[model samples]
Target: MNPRITDHPAVPYERTRRVAFTFEGRTLHGYEGEPVATALHAAGVRVLSRSFKYHRPRGIGLTCGAPSCPNCQLTIDGQYGVPGCATPLRGGESVRRERAWPSADHDLFGVIDRFSPFIRAGFQFRLFRRSPRLAHLAERVMGLIAGGGREVTPDAIARAARPGLGERRTALAVVGAGVAGLAGALAAADAGLEVVLVDQGAEPGGALRAETAPVRTPDGGAAPGFALAAELAARAAAHPAIEVLTGSTALGWYEGGVLPVHTPSGVLTLRPARLLVATGDYDQPLLFPGNDRPGVMVAGAVQRLVNIDHVRPGSRAVVVTRDAYGYAVAAQLCAVGVEIAALVDPRPGERAGADAEASFPSGVAASGVPHLTGHRLREALGRRTVTGVVVEPQEGVDGRGRAVRLDCDVVVVSAGRRPAEELLLQRLYHGDITLDPGPGTALPDGVAVAGGAAGITDPAEALTTGADAGARLARWSPENPALPEISPYPLSPGQAGRPSSSGGTSE
Candidate 1:
């Protein structure tokens, strides 16, 4: 079934020019500028790769926009291990599944999952310990099975041999193009400082580009978050002192303010007097059996697919959340004509108190979707893909509760988020950085952080912090030191039960 969404209210879908690409020797069509993963997903190709050891089927789970997961890594255009989620679809690109024997859909090695118990960690060394010849053969076979991608093509080798490193300097460099980064860039530009704003996304809005709900503006009006992002992006583009670079990945920060950034064109060495890191956060996946199944996905990934890529994740979904963010995601799904089988919140208390109910979108309650409070996800049900889910009430809440089965093709998770602060942490401290440190705590000289990187998830707070950081790095003090006038949506009272301040994690 075609899962492309054409009737989203918040972000209207427009027919764009289509590009034809070859995947596994078969030609497929997708819109230009969309990611290869979404293209494949829209074309009904779910299984992207196989797990390293168990050879279990895997899809583009957490690799939606963030390249943190390896599930969607494919051999693209004869290059090995390219992230399909981040690579935009250009016409005529050759894509192939990696790490799967025969094909991702019908892998012969899938039987390894049935004997996973025998293949425990470091079992390879002991499995054929007695026979040296058997152990050597097993080692070679395992190496071939684990290796992904084919030999590098001659074209790829030629391109790699070309020297294309560039260098530039700026007064201030902001390392994200979200609301916070935009605000920071604008603030720095207003202070007459030359600024460079870099982001890895195809667009400049960051996660705001994925929001389908309308947010309250500063002037008592309401606008969609994507619209607000567009406005900020336009202003940044028009600003004389701000240079906005999209589709650019900031590799890392080195000694003496040296930063190497990778772009579609070439690598650029950037040296800035001061830096502001607003890289934001990643959606933390939940811990459960079958959570890594093909049809299960993080809430942020689903939002990005629906609102940004205009693709429906599935026909029916089971939403498992720990905070109000999940309900918002459910509302967006409902708005786009996806069925919500159930909304499960594992926290104890009455089934969504009055305050929590108020936080939910009116459509959610009006549609009569089931709400299971104090219910935890026991396991996601399905083997190759998610066919349903099993949920049970939290222990010690009341008398023993029986597990309830909810049939769904998709499972949306919004457990919580962990800060994406790799760049900042590398620059400041060698030790582990705290996930939820107070804003602006223990930051080193000539460096600042804002937004989720600084542990501020609220949009309003992120904007304010970003503006402050930009102004501070420029050493400009306005007469009126007040928060910026951009008022985005704030977390509701229902969010009080969000994951602990330490942040959420994946198993």
Candidate 2:
């Protein structure tokens, strides 16, 4: 038996209309205007979805603005591949879940379990070498099942939606409040169109709020991205034509420029004449054994936990990096009195920028993450939760890898960030965001890209870009600026490039 959706008098409720929805043919109830994830969470459905390759259990992350994570994919009515995070709920909607073939929880594909003894992480090449014919047969079977993955393609995702997206309007809607988004909104607003700017953070600033590293300003005044975000947010708020909806995210975008922004309050349908999407990216965590331990978190998630939420993800942590920005996060965290276990960079004396690398936290064990040239996280130690981490040499057998389990709960993985372009993928699918090598889709016809969307990686560039976006909306020529000398989305510390003479790199 499932708990019925009811408004407990013990807790004050918000909505008046009740909505009926279904998940995997299971009749469920939700509010008329609540996020599908929110309803699921409220109904004690913690395991909202699972991963593709491993078919691991996953649930809601901080927000449900995109389909990046595998947690929120379930079938609606007869629909599949719909991201429950980005998809909301409505009355009379039926959703059927596509659990793995046998079942969602206990899939027979556990045959991978039989091969674990012979194979380790990244062992496809090794397996092929041992038995070419057998390995070839297995590979063929894997491809037949897309390596045994789900059937949700990109097109199926675009056509999924909830309900109750009528009655509100926006001339121009910008779906991010970070540096790039702010710039885009200002530019669109100056063009004399009322704009709705939505962001998931409490402040309009996105990554800037979580980016704790110091940014070298033109005059040498050291300014962290957070500080620049603070200033830019104020200017954006002062704009009369721009409605700053902080703590709000474009839950999803629909036809006719209708974007429903969700906050703690509820979902608001903003009908924009144009959309300037600047939803920033997030550092992706690498998939390794025991990667889902409690202490293990994304570098960006830790930064937000420490700086914005005023909470530490762990008292002591290990940061695995091949990038300079990973060290930047380490320095910021150490300065905040958090104990550092080690700073493992997989790259060599890799120039982390003489000017910038000088800032990596001192007196800590900063070495390559790979100890024996190709070390990977082997097993996350703990019974109920994460108590330690064991990074071992790559390509080990069932028990061949050397393990170094550190006495720490938090393991911050700086894998790297991908553009939070899931929503943009919709346009790209509908042939909106073209595959153009330049300007990506003719700037979406009246939609101007600014900040990260326009490839602006610096806080300083964000300000200029945003101001320029506003000016461009008003028919001014503000040449799109170049990216910062330092990579804002740093994946490799040694991958630093000198900025163009103009002091940045633009697409």
Candidate 3:
């Protein structure tokens, strides 16, 4: 029950239906639509998988529920390579950690961790060169031993995949249904242009889905941010022109401006006259020696666990950050009875020898939480999972800088975010296009960027950017009639229903 957040203040526990599953041969209970990782984490199962080379235990990295990460990859229902964190739990499913013999907890391949240094860098080419054939044999043997999960059965592949959704035509296609994407879809639809909103989540509202803080509304009023997310999502869902495709992703650009979208049902090749990309940023991992431990996760991951999944990350935690985001994570944790061990901040203007800062922002104002200035996380201490963290004072010390160790099971890192620029970069590399990384830059003729992917983090600003892009697309498209310009609601500080402006790089 310590890891289970049943009565959390920020998020309500409303599971769809009770279901049973087997994890590593043990029967476990979970909700039908919830992520398998959420149920496992709530049941006090931290180290879900292991790294390939070192076989080091891993829980969830950034915990974005993205299939791109390896933390959630496991063997599911006799099929190898499944995303435990993103996949919904179906009753009576069997899940096992892949790439480990015996089990992920007691893996036979774990001995490689001790001998990693000897065989890490080009060791295969260096040592296994008796003959080309012998070397090839050795490589094959090693690959079979330390490579990946069991072979994916052909029957599973045939049954799992269905036919594609075929080509879809629209006036505008907005990728990534975060705040910016959602706003852009609504704005374009309101402007009388057909919109296809595609997202990689089960529902709309990227981080807004997990946010618990109250935000400003266009009316300069405040309300719970999640409530605002719900309203905006509801409106988008009911919009006539807006085709909200949740649990889907815009894979990449194809020839003839066709964008391949992968959804749970099937694949969709969307051909929109104008494209607005609003893929948001992912939380960046902090720089520390033991940052990759099992219990170490980014602040956003903690928010997702607590707010979205209603799972307590850990009993005691340490937040390492340089901005206000860390404090917000602490507040969310505190709401669920998780004790914040320390807030290690290493920003400029914070004195190295000072005790605690004079004041903190209202969003991160935790009375009992220890706010330590000029302190940076040096290392996380533990063999398998995080047990404690070592913090050291920043530079400009009077030669009296000493490292301090704080005991904690989890380390929630808030080291800023990096834009999701894979699709953008892919376009730049292959397509003949020049993109300037700035507040507003001209893109290719038919493609435009908005929101976090365009380097805008403020919710209201992102909305405005989306609306601007939508209006521009509507005006440019010859098929759509010239409608009035769409505008988002105006907002003031602390107004509810709109997210506060935060981090994003230019362009």
Best candidate according to TM-score:
3
Tell me the whole-model lDDT of each prediction, alpha carbons only: 0.76, 0.56, 0.72
TM-score of each: 0.88, 0.59, 0.89
Question: Residue 40 in model 2: shift from native, Å?
Answer: 18
Question: For model 2, what is the error of residue 425's alpha carbon versus the real structure, in angstroms, after optimal superposition?
Answer: 1.2
- Which one is best on lDDT? 1
Task: Encode model 1's per-residue lDDT on 1-507: one tens digit a residue.
Answer: 359887678787686789999999899999998999989999998888887878888887554544367888888877877888888997889899988778888889889899988888878679878888988888778867875424788997776553557789888889999888988889989999999999998888888877755554546676677787788889999999998888898988877778888877788899987788888776778899998899899888888899889899999999988776777787788878899999888776554433246445364457688877788899988888899999998886642468999999899998777667778656546532333243333443566777766556666556667777788777732333343422122111112123222121110
**Ranked candidates (lDDT, high to low):** 1, 3, 2
Lowest summed lDDT window (length 10), candidate 3 = 490-499
**Model 2 lDDT, full chain set:** 0.56
* Runs off by more than 4 Å, candidate 3: 63-67, 348-366, 397-401, 435-442, 478-507
Question: Per-residue lDDT for 1-507 in model 2, tens only?
Answer: 122323221112346476777765577777765456656655655455444544444454422222355555777654666566455566777664344555544555545544656656656667677888987787766654322344665655554433554557666677778877776676667678787788766567776765555555546676656666676688789999988887566766666666777654566777665566666555556676667634566666556545543344556777775555566666666656567776654443333333124445342325222222245566667632457877764453222445677777567776655456666666557654455554234444445555555445556665566555545544422243332211122121112222221211111
**Model 3 agreement with the true structure over 1-507: per-residue lDDT tens digits:** 367677877666686788999988799998888888888877777778877667778787454533268876777877776777778887898888777778787778888888877876667777766677877877777766754434777877886886888988888998887777877788779989889988888888887777776655567876565666777789999999898998887888766778999888888888888888877766777777877888899877788788888878888999887655566677678778888898887865344112223223442344667666767888999987899999988776322358888999999987766666567666666754554464323355656677667555566666668767777776765444343332222111111121123321211
Give the winner by lDDT: 2 or 3. Answer: 3
